[model samples]
Target: MIPYQKALAALACAAGLLTGNTAAAAPDAYPQQPVRLIVPYAPGGGTDSMARALARKLSEIWRQKVIVENRPGASESIAASAVARAPADGYTLLFASDSTFQLNPLLYNHLSYDPDKDLVPITRFAASPFALFVNADTPVKTFQDFLSYARQHKGKTFYGSYGVSNSTNLGLSWLSKQFDLDMVHIPFAGQGPAMIALLGGEIQILFGNIIPSSIGFIDQGKVRVLVVSGEQRLPNAPDVPTFRELGHDNLDTGYTLGLAAPAGVDPAIQRQIAEAVKQAVADPELIKYAAETLSIRLFAEPSGQYRDFIADSRRILQQRIEAAGIGKLDQ
Candidate 1:
């Protein structure tokens, strides 16, 4: 194992995986008025869906409307900054992809809100592990096969991501180096175009989300999923092995859909919100929605575990970016 991989192995046990009975009732010390859940992405993507779902549940529990406010733009800095500047009250919370707390801070130098200083993690409600993909038309049928093929093809094999220095690029670049695959990287304007390129065979490889995108295609047989990230197999594809199960260590991270608040919120209030989330996550309706509609893994850990996960992820991602030889986006 490499240096980062060995380090990550130690975190395997400490990494956040919240599982238990529904939490007891919260103190309800906060949220007398309507609460605003700010989402950094537009109102249609997975993060937005997750925000809306959790907001609805929270609304029902708190009896105060939990409105999902979309402030999508600037690679999520817009919403992040807005929440960071908001009063350190329980009413204003950020529900966004963990990248806002992880990748963005490392990649963008001009970011307005310092995540480490301004934001406190509330809970990580859901996550979607990445699955390795290849077009069915490709001759390679497995990861090892693809590795051999890529080694033979060298410059001919291609991998693509939606943006530079983004999670997709970062992971793919790291994978390329770890395996010495020598595959070329291409950046698409967005995931939609990137998926289109993959389906059209313009690109041979892409890391796909387990839900709606990759899982949907797996049935249609348009793409072959060689492996998945995370510590275990996906609910949608139980037969597929995780990176660790396949003897590839340190590739356990996933796209986390979570909640955070401006730093300095009362720790008691944070615990209240986290308890509400834990109960909401255990809801049968949400369990169904996440598993069937969204295909997400639920981890309803409270503030402390959420904080630790973000810190560990940030440190590991920094090591990954450095290992991949990627520099800051502005530079």
Candidate 2:
């Protein structure tokens, strides 16, 4: 029995109140509280250092606390799965290498979290070449020397990796299959243990990063790098040739570090944080720190471009694994 004009007025008032309450409950902001950046490696590694640097810069930009937590194990699956299950509020992030997304899927028969569905790429900040290294006690001094030695030793030789079915181990597996080189794979909990095994003469070869681990050993003449895996040779190890130069084209992909958030995050929020990361990489102080301390170059790729790059990498890895007949891990 109410007039039309009065009913329309009441409906508008109700809509206004609902909008106000919704805005109050959830601010249309990117980051409203402390952000947690999870790293899938032990503290003091290159990825950890980069994550900390990014955390500091992001905190300054957002004026909010940013925490870096390490959950290293299971070939980075532990930390990655934890982040994947986190709320999609843009507060929890994962800083990991290409291996976490690219290789882990092909390695493990079943994964706790789906890399493609549970996590989305945010951006990539840095990349560096990995090297084929041997302990100083080992008889090999060059790639040729190591290849000859591996062929001669056959199944008796041992190789250590940062983790099972990781990029480091997969590289060895691909090489072993291609050249008919038989070397046992010894997977460690982390890089520290693998480095110790290499240095202690428990393992003869290691496919590892250039920073924090091999640099000190190479400087002290405790480890010999036979080939560097990248497009070009490293400045510090200019004498070392790339895997491509050595006629192994498939091993040319290097290590990459990037940030990812749980899937279903607000697209606007993802862009906001991704821009913050791009700006952070351009900071002069962070550049100096990465070059001097990490012995790696700093680079940045936006979320869209990084996603494409990772897709290409994943395709290549899958093809290589299948071609090599590397079966999936039961665990």
Candidate 3:
């Protein structure tokens, strides 16, 4: 036997050299193909708009096609689960809201994937403030007026939300409990449907995110905003009071959107995606569109900080759900 020790050492050296070559080749020429961004909602929604903006910016920067795929159903869980089961090669990404990551896990008894474990938070992209609105024809002109009317009407008063187990629904639930008011919850397929129902007089009140589509109706005197559920008043809707200002600090809710990848993605790949998203969100055109058209506050936090924020949000939402006695939907 020609020196067994030397033979083993030679094998080790060869393996090390091959591993180095693979790493170098992979990282240097990453994203040699187009990337797919999965949005877990129907097209024409706020999430779809945000995803399209991100794709446009990233495609420009990377010089590679960034395609957006809408997989709407199950209140965004279907899309999230798809991304979770995708390859960890950084080719697939998920653009989702807090409901998919933080609230869904608590609201549903069983989920195909655990967001905290299966998804890696890349960055927070944007946030839209949730607001309380009533029909312009309704007698309620202010938050005080709505509350007083709600108390007197009790169960007769109603509020519509995007869907059951959504952030808006939970926010309204918590508010109703805190105020000792009997407000009926009307769940719709989405914000658009809920807004239509409100406009058609199917529902009296709506708690929703302030989007251009909804705000247009408000501007046309079809809906009247009572109070926004943000820490402070929105820049566009400065005249509307905040939940804090209305003496309902506990009702403050934020519906934020962010980018995430499946967990166990290579650290280098994670960094690359995060950098791309940071650049995308910071694009001047995107900023202008988000500020002027979407009326969304552009808040971006890097991967690590966003992960921490998600954890904190999950905890807070869990507490609120339990306190409100909200039951999970059967999966």
**Residue 143 of candidate 1: its Cα lDDT?**
79
TM-score of 2: 0.87
Alpha-carbon runs more than 4 Å astray in model 3: 1-24
For candidate 2, the C-alpha RMSD (Å) to the true structure equals: 4.4
Cα shift from native, residue 62, model 1 (Å): 2.5
Ranking by lDDT: 2, 3, 1
Against the hidden reference, what TM-scores do the models get?
Answer: 0.77, 0.87, 0.87
RMSD of each: 14.1, 4.4, 4.4
Candidate 3 local accuracy as lDDT? 0.81
Q: Supply candidate 1's per-residue lDDT for 265.
A: 84
The Cα error of candidate 2 at residue 237, in Å, is 2.1
Candidate 1, residues 70-175: lDDT per residue as tens digits? Answer: 8866666778899999998778999757567888888877778888899888788787777788888888888788888888888788897745645777778888
Model 1 worst lDDT run, 10 consecutive residues: 18-27
Give candidate 2 regions above 4 Å deviation.
1-28
lDDT of 3 by residue, 105-179 (tens): 889888888898898888887888787879777789988888898899899878887667678788888988888
